[model samples]
Target: MANPGGGTVCNGKLHNHKKQSNGLQSRNCTKNGIVKEAQQNGKTHFYDKLIVESFEEAPLHVMVFTYMGYGIGTLFGYLRDFLRNWGIEKCNAAVERKEQRDFVPLYQDFENFYTRNLYMRIRDNWNRPICSAPGPLFDVMERVSDDYNWTFRFTGRVIKDVINMGSYNFLGLAAKYDESMRTIKDVLEVYGTGVSSTRHEMGTLDKHKELEDLVAKFLNVEAAMVFGMGFATNSMNIPALVGKGCLILSDELNHTSLVLGARLSGATIRIFKHNNTQSLEKLLRDAVIYGQPRTRRAWKKILILVEGVYSMEGSIVHLPQIIALKKKYKAYLYMDEAHSIGAVGPTGRGVTEFFGLDPHEVDVLMGTFTKSFGAAGGYIAGRKVREGPLVSV
Candidate 1:
């Protein structure tokens, strides 16, 4: 079938027509034809003049159209109910097909199982694409199709301008800020790209030293070491700080990186209820009294790990209470401020400044530049600057 825009809908595929430069001609091609043509031509161009019309009915598109029909005084509640039932039936059929070799067993293939069982439920369900620059408000393409699977043919159709509600521009210093962009551009022009190697292996730029000094001055710490990755900062450093005979008391709701780091450290790890000083104290007391399992000897070292702000919970950590407990238990404190560092406090100095506490109170301070700083990588701040790889006793 042909739409008003000279586009064709054939066998659950979109056939787009383009006016070739040779003449006033409309060449209709299916999805596969378009892909093959692009491969032959080495590049493909999108014609703004050619308007596409009808598309296949994907589940999300169907629901959207059904809802719109209801809003416009049509009885679509029954249709919505029917679609839900259909989806449930499809799910049930997939689950019951034990002999189907195409579908991997849940135990054998975890990712594929999740894709089939969970992801498919809402796959191609929504199209909130940003067509223009990522600002406070931008253009979103609203399109629906039956054959529009997430893993298959998904296209941007029916563009509409809307305000962005979901974004990681925590401090409003992203693309919207001109000064930051200009500064970044200037730096990019001068520096080209990355340093290309780890700092130990001749990757240390003068800019690196300046940044570390600035971070230390800002955090009111003696020294700071920056890493290329925020996640790796925690993952790699935790193991260096504590090991075998040492004990690690971690917040139950700590970030995945911290959990992984603690696990790799080979430390006797005990979890405390998130943000609960009482629970933390109990765990500390028990660890101090019991020590290692079977041996009951004193731990070589005790490390208390927590976050300045819980990213998932949106709750601030009880730093004062935790600090008191750490002091009482004689445990080193490691605070991850990935979300809090540049997003909290009047001057954006992080949780330490927010809580009116000294930065030195926390043994190790960790944060990332991906959020408020609008940069990449992470940093680890501490009392003294150490050369080579960090080694904690």
Candidate 2:
């Protein structure tokens, strides 16, 4: 049934109801037969609060919204699924038509094997929904299935109120603590979720400047630049800082973002053993002595990149020793404190504070707000300013 305003009424409930121009309202009936609406607006008022409240009341199932528009998005989604199924069917048909001895090995074989044997197995056992916000303790839906199938169902049974040992909520700031939630609520009411523009454009809010200043004060740095994403903070800015004719000494076990940024910098890259100052020193000395490859000319700059904490190994960087080597070699140091910023040190000032070294000793201090601050995005801090291309979202 269609309403007078072009909204659809399904199962005695109104759906796709639009109160404002160019907006969508998707309603779902809760388990208790209460109809709740989820709204999607272009710039503001995304999702109604009642939809979230409905989820809190009945956590077993979720309603998927069917959005209508130009149909391009829906078409693409169906096209992707169709192509994927077609490829699988074609592969299976080819295997059946040919003998095992006559089969030609392809890269798809490895991908298929890994997808079926490894990824599916791990995903089936581990992937589940966390009922509560991230903190030291929360609720998670425990996977009840042991099989590796494409479609799997979760049991209504929830491992309620379990100690959260998996997430990176370092300072236990998540779980909507009273003070944080109050501040967040006020901000949301004023800002309406996001600025909807890039920092270089009209998106630069007073809060952005204030947060940057606060981060600089906390890290004891001269200036800081905040990015929209933690991963982009490293991946995008590294290319701006160093380019061709520079030498990059990176830790072997550095994060992939750092690796990508270093590669994009178009500099000579060398990897040292993880957290090994001796190996770093050796690489630094060799680079300083040999200079750039083929050209044999002195490098414009030498950048030593390491992380505050190795996320995979859970080992903190040897900052003091690394700083000493950087000073000796006249190399600039870039420290990624994504994991250590709010988790390490006496007061959570990161690895520099934990090692009793001055933050100024490190040339560039980079960290993410996702961990301890219970927020998104990242920041880059430095003593001097270097102009680079600004990324617009």
Question: Which candidate should be chosen as best, given TM-score against the real structure?
Answer: 2
- Relative to the true structure, candidate 2 reaches a TM of 0.68
* Candidate 1: regions farther than 4 A off: 1-115, 123-133, 141-148, 152-160, 385-393
Q: Candidate 1 overall Cα lDDT vs. reference? A: 0.71
**Candidate 1, 1-393: lDDT as tens digits:** 343333443332334555465444444334412221122232332211111233354798889987785464323333533564577433232343646757665554333544544444455444356676556777776655463243343365645667777655677666575876888799989997897788889899988899999999999999898888899999999998989999899999999999999999998899988777677777777888898899999988889899988887777887755665666577789999999998887789998777556687788999998878767889999788433233421
State the displacement of the C-alpha of residue 119, model 1, in Å, after optimal TM-score superposition.
3.1
Model 2: lDDT of residue 373: 84
Clashes of each: 6, 0
